[model samples]
Target: MKKIKNVRTVALDGLNAIENNQAYSNLLLNSLIEKNKLPQKDIPLLTEIIYGTLQRKLTLDYYLSFFLKGKKKIDDWVQNLLRLSLYQMVYLDRIPDRAVLFEAVEIAKARGHRGIASMVNGTLRNIQRNGLPEIEEIKDPIERISVKTSTPKWLVKRLSNQYGIEVAEQIFLEQLKPAKQTARVNVNKATVENVLELLQKDGLEVTKGEIVPESIQVIKGNIAHSHVFKQGLYTIQDESSMLVAKALDINEGEMVLDSCAAPGGKSTHIAEMLSNTGKVISLDLHEHKVKLIEGQASRLGLTNVETKVMDARKVGEHFQAETFDKILVDAPCTGFGVIRRKPEIKYSKTDKDVHSLATIQKEILQAVAPLLKRGGLLVYSTCTVDQEENSNVIYDFLQQTCDFIKDDTLASRMPEKVAAHVDNGELQILPQYFQSDGFYISALRKKV
Candidate 1:
């Protein structure tokens, strides 16, 4: 890879890769940052350009459409350059319009012919002079929300139908903001107060997490690379995600199963809650993912986590019925919840994806049901706010499985601020509600 000298070019290349290869924004951006060895100061600009462009892609394209009208086709890279430039000019107030225009033209000239550079220059100058097109002009409410928030029309409609239009709009707007960096304190290694003091001593801005009691929000600096994190005193996780282990209500000597566990955030949290006395059988479909679980366990010095590479739907084949005291089905879904962190998901996922994932979720729950002991809790979770993949899936499962009943005490286990939203043992957390990822968690108890 050629060394990119500036953040604009880096941002443009990242955007092109994401568009051409269907790459995830977060993974691709992180890889780009590491490969380029970007200066500490440039990293933030590169991240903002890439994520902001992706987050507001539809709106940026709408602005570009007015300028590109009747023009000959341009290369994807050229379009990406314009999108990133437009993103900085319109959304980022810190960067001046002249600097954005200068960088766009320079990058275009360096990578393309003078003709392409001129076109880029002219298009940007034209926008600066004429101003952006009006999002309000779009008459359809769904279309307006879609362009205004850079969300898909189908998703906007789906959310609006599920949660009223006003709430859906709030969710979309909330996703446009940056995600908070939070870490879960490994109480087995250090108390929350101790970890906060250590992190602050390291010059990181830290504060108590709003929702999960064991979590702390990093107001500044990367906590993942902090000494405390590497010491296994804490693990970086979203505050909403930290709630999973707490919902399980683990005891010291119980046997817990984490179905579809990967990158082991929740699995390790469960292990810590058990105080290393109980065993957490963490399973994922791929060997590489299982290794991730093992790696986290090793780093955290957690001895009670046992990892296995197995399809969650095939758990019954290897384990005896009623073999575990508790089970977690953190089944995969459309991932509509973490849009602020992975903005590409908004465009990449579709209505069909939601329904298909719902089917897979139900299957996973059915396969794991028999493995839980009588009266043992089975917690279901997904990082999505879509009803089809969350509540609807749980509703359908409860209808079919006669042995399991909703655990009404689930709300009491959650933070008091969030407890009121729990209904019939289910909690659907929207991004707007707590400024966290849109997550859904529900609990069921085997009553037979």
Candidate 2:
């Protein structure tokens, strides 16, 4: 573990770790930023370089391939250095090409032999001298989209099959852009208006969210460190995720189960909806994750959230039948919907992973189905646009159980724009749909 001092070095190291599957992009970048103690201004640049390089990795590689035609065994670090330099040179117009090339050569010399630094300099200088390879020349549509958008060809094809090619391309194009920073107002402690005013006073560019009524979209400045957030006035959550608690249709005095809750965003939201009158039992498989739920609950001054360390699939062993008034199975999936924030998912996940997760999602749903009280509501949601893990899973579950039916009232609980997407009580929200995470939410009700 050598020390990472500058933004470029940090970004390069982060990219290498992600490329080797040694770390996830989000976690690795955060760790690197903290370890380096980078300046606030430098943090954005570091984030941009790393995420931009990752978001357009295939495109960058395509551009590099034309230049590195004879090079067969390029070291991962050297390649990453080249990619980082090229990303800044191509995407970041604010930074001149001379500065990017100088940093690349300097970092290369510091880390590798002079010959390697020369090679790095030559590759980038050549790329700068002659523009990147043309992506439009690619004959295949899937390959063109994959390289153009830096998405995997398999993913492009899957989305294309699920959504038409046009919509899938739109989804890819949207994910290439940055994710919006939105937070849910803790209505128990502050009104959306009050939070907006306070955040604005603090110099944050803020506005009401488009989808969820309680959400505030942060246009600029980090809201997590604001006094309002410290006071539990709001919780940083995606606008789409805030819809999960709402879809659950929680009441003031009811036992709600967040079967797979971790880092408890939805659980705390449910607790707020309960107005501290009832308990929201949050469960996660790992002890550390359960602690995350507890930490969030404590931070929000929510005393009604009871956290448990248990596997969601084993809910039958711990709880009696028909116990909870409402349940949320925010089951894990392929995570294709959140690529804008975590670009690694595009290359890391596979079709096999999707099928495997679908199986686990179904198991979690079946395991929790009996625990809901007769006529109790259960909301199934995933941060993925994959139909197999979303609609297919819900449809299969309905076929297996006669006691539950799609809750038609789910539409009424959603925003008008989102409500129109609801079909048979399931809403598959694409990233292009509202510039939100590709999310799915479905409500099911057990027969009374």
Per-residue lDDT for 209-313 in model 2, tens only?
998989999999999788788788888999889889989988899999999999899999999999999899999999999999998888899999999999999
Off by over 4 Å in 2: 1-4
The TM-score of candidate 2 is 0.98
* lDDT (Cα, tens digit) per residue for candidate 1, span 153-191: 999999999999999999999999999998898988888
TM-score of each: 0.98, 0.98
**Root-mean-square deviation (CA) per prediction:** 1.2, 1.5
- What is the C-alpha RMSD, rounded to one decimal, of candidate 2? 1.5
- Which stretches in model 1 have alpha-carbon errors above 4 Å? 1-4
Which residue pairs in candidate 2 collide? Answer: none
Give lDDT per model, in order: 0.92, 0.92
